[model samples]
Target: MKIQYFIPAMIYSLAFALQASANHPGSNLDDVMSEKETFFQAINEPDAPSFELINAQGELKKLADYEDKIVVLNFIFSNCAGVCPLHSARIADIQEKINSTPMKRLVQFISITTDPGNDVGSTLEEYGQTHGLDPINWEFLTKKADDPEDFTRKLAMEYGVKFQPEEAGQQMHGVVTFIIDRGSRFAAKFHGLKFKPINLILYVNGLSHQEKKQKQSFLVRWWEVIYYYFIH
Candidate 1:
């Protein structure tokens, strides 16, 4: 199994699991969230865009690093005196709620800086701290040492948002919190600052349980096949 093929394979397996579960379910969690959360937008896209950004400690981080955990991802620059701060605080609130429960271990919170040049060193670390983002399950990432100035900003665009830099050290962009399921499946987005924090939390909780349900469903099917062929 080459690394490149691994994600697609996981996506296929996940799709099978979801379809299998759909047959027995009362209502799909994705659908439930869509109805309950006015701002929740369900997406069935492929793997999210790849990135090779660096954290505050200068270690290289990629999308694959958190493949085992449901990723709560967003993009922001540290210097933004506008909606960026509010957006980050919203994420922090969501992180806090999730961390209080067992879901904390199953989720990963990622904040990528669109302006990596200024968001280096303590800047990255401080932004998280200032916004009450817990380090236990959250990370603020920036461009790597040799990355181009607009590297992360470009990556943001790949995710369907733009962070256009302005002369006053601000970037114009919308607030969207992305949810990537385990295995890098681009799952959903919680748009804007007005979404209920608990809605995002419940959605993440649903995603975490979905993986477990999928594995259980797979085992059940395997056993049925064995019984039909070898025992029955």
Candidate 2:
């Protein structure tokens, strides 16, 4: 009958209620958003294609390094005069919006270069600045010395985009912004620059909320088990 004894019961009830709401039909936010947003394509690949690349600081980085954060990923080279720049600029815009809110800490922005040969050293460090991408939660990645020249290009293809090199230092490719949810689930993609930035931000917010609810449900169940043993 004590107030403290009722705390666990309240939490358990609330957790179950949330779980029920989450399990209700049409409750999948990713699928709902994909249908509502014209350019957003929702996917359910269990594991995103992995990659090990180098950051601008010459340090090694991998897809797993961002395990707990939502990833906004794209591919670009420093020298392109075409859609690469446009795609990066669009990402920069999205990053700015996300950073303005508390969600900044929960998201990471990644740009992998298809032209590692030219996008080395200062080129890697300066590309973000030139394109308005902040270095706070963003990285411009390139292949390492031991990697093949087309290493990142192949990885990009795995993500469903191709960076086919062409004459005059240009590469032919479509622009796509991939959204990888926490735990490396390939959640969705925003194709082309036509998609509204707000739509992507909202989708990411939905994913973040979904993850929070899952964690809360787990903690509630854990607390209930501990309380049951303590009462006896």
Candidate 3:
């Protein structure tokens, strides 16, 4: 075949292969949707719960502030010596991958402290630095003074997470990472420290461009079938 000669199936197959090589984006197909469901619990509520807090730099940060970008939300305490560190590392890993993709600018990473009392000021900043979180698009936040102190702790509760103080100022809490869409709607959650970071990254990649009609399409991976039937 001449290089100038091309067919619809060939072009579609090439484009689909390129996309598959990168991050798998939004899919309306039941199998893909079901796979996402098996990995992250969906919370497509009318409105996601909101919060008001300050980042490590003392800048005001809120849920509404990121209404235009997909938000990856997590909970951690500066003093945590167990799963929290692992959780932050997981986020860092996910961040590195997201940074390598176009979705990096389309996403915001937020870590809310469950122990706001000790996770403030330079302490939070140092924690992020130690974990290699770039401050450009990432923030380590806690409750501001005169904000009831327990503001973030209770906020975690609203996200269905709980934290109990332990010896040496550490905390015992559930490990979960949440995803919120551009419209401020809670999308899904990658629970525990074991969920693949790539899954969340791909999930965010999908949500970053997902639309109503795309989510209602007959098959999101129809090109796979196309290539299989036409080329194979």
Candidate 4:
């Protein structure tokens, strides 16, 4: 149900051939391999996903905005009276821990709605307040929940999240929280109930360092200059 930004395998193969012809031996292969590896790691990494859907101030959000920040993503539907509250409480504990540490700016948390139709902006706001979540640090997002589906399904599938509607609203069998590193790749995953605050902090800190090094790489510098030159 998710639309992906990645090009199809055939397209990648064609592009690889063309790039290979235009570049040095194995240069294209290296580039293609690196790109493929990043994608592979994103999905193959335990409990990690490539993207998430968020509603920031009543609008949709993509993964790019938090590219430089350590991101925590999870799925929760507001109306659930069961496991969701406990899940949120655990997340709250993690947030409180992160808020007390120096990793604040380097970290961001996103909780997406599994039942987007009923979980509108106002509902999300109230839920945030009820849980003592800081709006700036925590984002509760939703989208239209028509039969055709919307951003919710796209994002959920992209991240491999699973949720099903129930009597009151919906229930989620997926209890995992995705940990996305700086490259927008999933770095780790934790269960909603058993995830540790300290471990998350350590993982995020390690990712921050990795992201810093990747940015400082020679290729990234060259791309930055080229990007600015064309865009500016």
By TM-score, the candidates rank as 2, 1, 3, 4
Error of 3 at 49 (Å): 1.6
Candidate 2 global lDDT: 0.77
Per-residue lDDT tens digits for candidate 4, residues 1-232, read 1222121222223222221111112222234223322222222243244443446365656678787677887778788877888788778877876666455676798888777777876888899888877877889977633334455656676676667655655564567677776646566456556543544443343344322333225333433343344322
List TM-scores for all candidates, in order: 0.79, 0.79, 0.78, 0.64
Question: What order do you get sorting by lDDT, best first?
Answer: 2, 1, 3, 4
Relative to the true structure, how large is the alpha-carbon lDDT of every model? 0.76, 0.77, 0.70, 0.57
Measured by C-alpha RMSD in angstroms, how accurate is candidate 1? 12.2
Model 2 earns a TM-score of 0.79
Model 1 weakest 10-residue run by lDDT: 18-27
lDDT of 2 by residue, 78-101 (tens): 888888888888899889877766
Quote the RMSD, in angstroms, for model 4: 14.9
TM-score of 4: 0.64
Instruction: Please identify which of the two predictions, 3 or 4, would achieve the higher lDDT against the true structure.
Output: 3
Question: How much does candidate 1 score in TM-score?
Answer: 0.79
